[model samples]
Target: MANTFQLEILASDRPFYVGAAEQLVFPTVDGLMGILPGHESMVTIVSPGELKYLVDGEWHYAAISEGFAEVRRDYVLVLGDAIELPEEIDAKRAAEAAERAKERLLHKQSIMQYYHSQAALNRAMNRLKISKRHNHEI
Candidate 1:
């Protein structure tokens, strides 16, 4: 059996997920990172992306925005500005958001608005991508 560790996910208000897992995969600012039990202690910035892990013989996925994780002594904790389950994503809403972002990008009256719109589009796309993949994994 694989070694297990206490895995916790925290957003602004409170803990979002708490459970035991053998491994975790989260999107770091630099790239994706993997964590295993008893792994080296470290902290890194996480991007607006998916976090995947195995727990209780099942895989789980969480979408997060601007977070970081801490690893130490068989425990891994993630603190993010926001987090959500894959199912919580509304496809239609995301699609509409993407469309709006694209429109804003095309009719850009301000540089800041244009770049921010681009980022929003990218984030919406990521959520859609992850949510779709999750349906297939089940």
Candidate 2:
């Protein structure tokens, strides 16, 4: 059996997951990053995208918003702005949010507002894509 490591995924509002995982893969500012048991310790910026983890030989997926991740030799801690199982995502809501964000971007706004809207759009689109992809399996 593959070696396992402790993994704890935390959302801003609540705990998302906590258990042993054989492997973990998540989007990072640079790109997709994978971690396994005894990974080197480091911290990195997590991008808004799909996060996957292997547990008991099964792969689990979740949509996660931007945040940070801390990797240790035997443990990995993820702190995300938001995180949701594919089934938990509401496609309609996500689409609506994406539209709203797009509209906001079209209008004149401060730099901060523009950046916020862009981030919101990215998160909403990512959630929508993940939701759609997993809807058939659910």
Candidate 3:
């Protein structure tokens, strides 16, 4: 049998997801990072991107916004600003949001505002991208 360990994804509001995984991937502020059992302990900031994991030989995906993640020997914990499982994303809604974000940028939003909107657009696009791969109806 393969080694199994607990994985958890949390949002500031609450615990978002908890399960078992053999490997996990998340977008870190520095870049994308992958975690596995016996990974070195560390903490890092997360960026807007897809979080992927392998559970019982099946792959799972989530769209995560900015936050933090911690890795330890037996578990990987993600605390995201926002998180959405593939099944929870609506492609049409995301596309609309992306368009709105582009408009916001074009209208000369502040730097912070631009980053925020850009992050939103990235999150929505990532959600739509990952969700579609799972045979989800767009």
Best by lDDT: 2
Model 2 alpha-carbon drift over 4 Å, by segment: none
Candidate 3 Cα errors over 4 Å, as ranges: none
Off by over 4 Å in 1: 136-138
How does residue 3 of candidate 3 score in lDDT? Answer: 85
lDDT of 3 by residue, 39-130 (tens): 99998988888888888898888888888888899988889877887787787898898888778878776899988887777877777787
TM-score: model 2 vs. ground truth: 0.95
Per-residue lDDT of candidate 2, residues 51-119 (tens digit): 999999999999999899999999999999999999999888999999999999999999999999999
Q: Candidate 1 lDDT, tens digit per residue, 1-138?
A: 579999999989778888889889999878899998889999889888989889877888977877789998699999988787888888778889999898888883788887799889988887788778776653
Best by TM-score: 2
lDDT on C-alpha atoms for all candidate structures = 0.85, 0.95, 0.83
The candidate, 1 or 2, that scores higher on lDDT is 2
**What TM-score would every model get versus the actual structure?**
0.87, 0.95, 0.86
RMSD of 1: 2.3
Ranking by TM-score: 2, 1, 3
Q: After superposition, how far is residue 5 of candidate 1 from its true place, in Å?
A: 1.5
Each candidate: RMSD to true structure?
2.3, 1.3, 1.9
User: Quick one: ranking by lDDT, best first?
Assistant: 2, 1, 3
